[model samples]
Target: MIAIETTGLEYTYTDGTNALSGVNFEAKEGEKVAVLGPNGSGKTTLFYHFNGLIKPTRGEVRVFGESISKNNIDKIRKRVGIVFQEPDSQLFAPTVYEDIAFGPKNLRLGSMEIKNRVTQVLHRFEIEALAQKNPSNLSGGQKKRAAIAGVVAMEPDILVLDEPTSGMDACGITGTMEILDELNDEGKTIIISTHDCDLAASWADRIYILNKGRVFKSGIPKHIFADEKLIAEAGLKQPVIVQTYREFRARGISRGEVPLSVLDFMDSVDVKVMNIRCAIAGCDVEAGDEVCLEIKNGMLIANKGSNGVTGRAVFDGKKGEDIAVRDVAGDILQHEGTITIIRVPGIIEGGSRAADLDRVRDILSKNKHQKMGAMGTSAKVLMTRLGLVCDFEFDVIQSGILAALRGFDVTILASGGMADRVAEKVKEKKLKYSCFVL
Candidate 1:
């Protein structure tokens, strides 16, 4: 049976911004498909159409053979559970248990049945300990898990998640993947809209690329990931493994096949792998060396290190008072509001750093407006932490971060050489400023 299907799905905002256009797509029963795209690529907009959260401008959406219309919305909602990109958006009740039980209660389940469903999902997600804690008080990863538990408690057949792994640490991503994998094994259809190429590469059996309200590509991940043109069009980077493969291929090395994961790359490693190879030949030396050569299994054993770029973040509010950043990186930050609209300079694009994105997301989440500043992959992760709405517009990357930084009351730009330039500009403009320097 078709779990979810849409024919020529199209949606447009009140302001006439086209969110989706003629999107024809479907997922089979028990299939795990990752809907990969940049922000505002219509991933979420298309998802909303599935449960009648929003009606399409044209075409139709069906779940389990039933068309999504006002009359069937209540029924559709029961079978399609959405775990939003930001956990905060899904959480409302003060306690986790109450929050989890809300959906079942709304469904009019008996008291005993509601309790059973909530307990089962909480234990399944291993969040029983947080049952009594305020949803607002949980950490970013914890909050994400709780939100998911609440969704799964409904026992939906089709699971739709928007940026499911956003704002999670490495461990958190792995754990969530495992749970999803188990659920899929139990016959659930999983659809996740995300920019986390690594996760999609590892978890999704199929991939769909959307851009500018249209479908750009759809196929098995192997085919989709290898489509260089399609990847570029979608405003995404090739996985790091794929990048490494390209580097090897450029040096006259025959890497018969490019691997998608690091482990796969390691298993296929019969020849030497160099990150930045030397320009000259003969002796294998670090990049920038006068001479270099290659050897089978040749690898540099360098310890993992931080970027060494740190700084104090200070946000100047509307009336002149400054909000100091208590903790730097690794701390979960949040905001709440309805964004009216956003005009960015263009910096929130593909090139934006991950750290820079987290800062922007934190700031946007606290405001209230509908039209908000769109962000790139890096910014998406940060916004995930703050539970803000962001877009992954191709033009945003093309426009440049400086342009993206222009309009915000408080811009959270990264420091280091970049910060130095901003500091210079501030001095030249004689704008009052206060920030912690790394």
Candidate 2:
């Protein structure tokens, strides 16, 4: 059965930006389809259409072969469940339990039936203990699970998630994937809109590329991901494993094809090492991993950025330092030279200057932490919003300053503290060039 289908689907926002145009696709029952695209590529708009949240500006949308019209809107909504991109947007009930039960209650189920459904969903999502906890107090991953549990309680035939695994740590990602897989196994159709190429490649049976408000390509993961030209054109980076293998090939090494996983790469390396042969002659295969493998000389490394100020430093083109060194009063500390160092002066109430608004904006863009309340919910977001890329010590900061003087592009460390010893570390590291003293 056709779970969902769209033909000539086109949508234009009120701002006059075209979000999607001429999109034609269909998902069969129990099929997993991944809509892959860069940011602002209409992935979210496409998903809204799936659940009838957004009426089509043009074209046709059918759920289970039933056209989405005024009479069927409510029915279609009941059959399709959408998990929004942001969990905070979906979770509004005071407690996790009430949030999960909201859908069943809206359906007007009897008190006993609603309790049973909510209990089953909470258990299924492994969030039984959080039933009484406030939604705002839940962790990022837990909040995501709660949002999903609420959707599952609806018993929708088609489960649509927007960036389902976004912002999750390794463990959280794995757990979510397992849950999705289990849901699929139970005969639910799953459709995901995501920018995570790795997740899409590993989990999606079929992949669709949406670019410039149109369908650029549609095929299996292996085929679409393997096409270097297509991936580059689509503004996506190839899988790291494939990139590594390609580099090896360019160094005069021969491999049959790019490996999809670590184990596959190791297997391919084994084959190449065992079958070493000159380019001028036919190859002879040797048994086992006994053949000698010779690597060409002259190593070259792609320098992404430098660490100090003096030694062949290349800036990341980010104007101004991440930390805005200011006095106890709010002031924009100016940089004196090419290298500047900043630090919090000491522990005084509101002693350090407020964050540089521009720098904060840049960090927010890079980390996608612009969503409201993200900083309050996740410590990682707070650190990142403050322009802390990686954890570093006071010693690193001082060393970075010295390295900057030596022509090494030095990076100032941001570990919030209020002490003379810590502040001295910032100066010693040569991070003091334009150091913002909070």
Candidate 3:
């Protein structure tokens, strides 16, 4: 069922401000949708209609097939919970618990049930520690959580958020999106409004671009951002990562769909870069081990690795084995010069399911940790299994090596087949570089 739908959705302010015009939008149940536009676009105005907070001047709004009118406003409000952009506006109760409990309390639910709901929201948002704090005393991130906790306590089927991460730091923004991801996983339909195209592109399944009170474009992010004319007409630029990819494309250096994030962009950078030669030394390394080495690129290059096995760097980017990085290379840090890579896939031969991908979501987003993995037997089939919301095409070993050359801080070393082959090439060139294993 469609969680929310609008036809010719038009709204005007009492003083004659034309907020929205003929905006037809739809979000199916359990889907994550994003509304993107500039400051004066109708994003906020459209959000108000989703839950019947504002009466439409023209057109109609529906929630689960029922028209949003005075008679059903209360019921729609319950199912279409909204968390406004500003936390101060939504949080007026004296205490955090009171603010969270406000909605359920209004339903005249038994005191015990309200208590249970308040507790659940606090835990879900990871705000149980702040349950007794005054709403005014909370930090900006805390207030945002408390505000969202209020609406979530209502058990809404569809949740509406307006620039929920507007004033947050990196950690705050990541934490907030993580919660929303979890909520969506729990079956709540999500609709959000923001000017963050990079974020929307990386997260949303579908996006609607609004301009001058109308939806100028609507589609998946890949197609939407590729349209130069539509993006220009809507007064928006492509996502930052897309712009970088295009710059590479314009110079005839990169190809394929634009990457959605830094890690993805790393994978997309041409992987056929020149291989470096180094002197061989240190303990012998196998399929799953860590090695430290250095090289030259004007600056001395160092290789870093995570504690886990780096099995990804050895696989033929297609079918030899499943791929994953050391939670550091070809996935996390972004830098601006050349570096050398030394570690190889560290997992013992025939190893599989080394770590749980689901648990890494928490580590990756807020902590800014790097990650790459797939639960398959080949690189060709090892993507889209983590529910990351972004698309990627990477030759694990080559991508890692190229990323390291382009100044990636950490990367796995090449082992066995590729290592031996590259060693022969180094001998053929008789360059100063030598081969080493660990």
Q: Who wins the TM-score comparison?
A: 3
**TM-score of each predicted structure versus truth:** 0.61, 0.61, 0.65
Best by lDDT: 3
Name the candidate, 1 or 3, with the larger TM-score value.
Answer: 3
Writing each residue's lDDT as its tens digit, candidate 1 over 1-438 gives 999999988888999999999999999998999988887888989888878888889998889888877787888898999998789899999899999999999989999999988876775576889999999999998999898888988889999988887888775675576567656755789999888887787668888888888988898877877777778867998887787877866765536666775534543443333223211122222322122111111221111123221122233222222223212232111111111222222222222332444444444465422333333222333344456544322222212222222222333322123334344444433333333221
Residues 39-85, candidate 2: write the lDDT tens digits.
88888999999978887889989999998988888889889999999
Model 3 CA deviation exceeding 4 Å by range: 273-438
Candidate 2 global TM-score: 0.61
Runs with alpha carbons beyond 4 Å of true place in candidate 1 = 252-254, 271-438
**The 10-residue segment with the lowest total lDDT in model 1:** 331-340
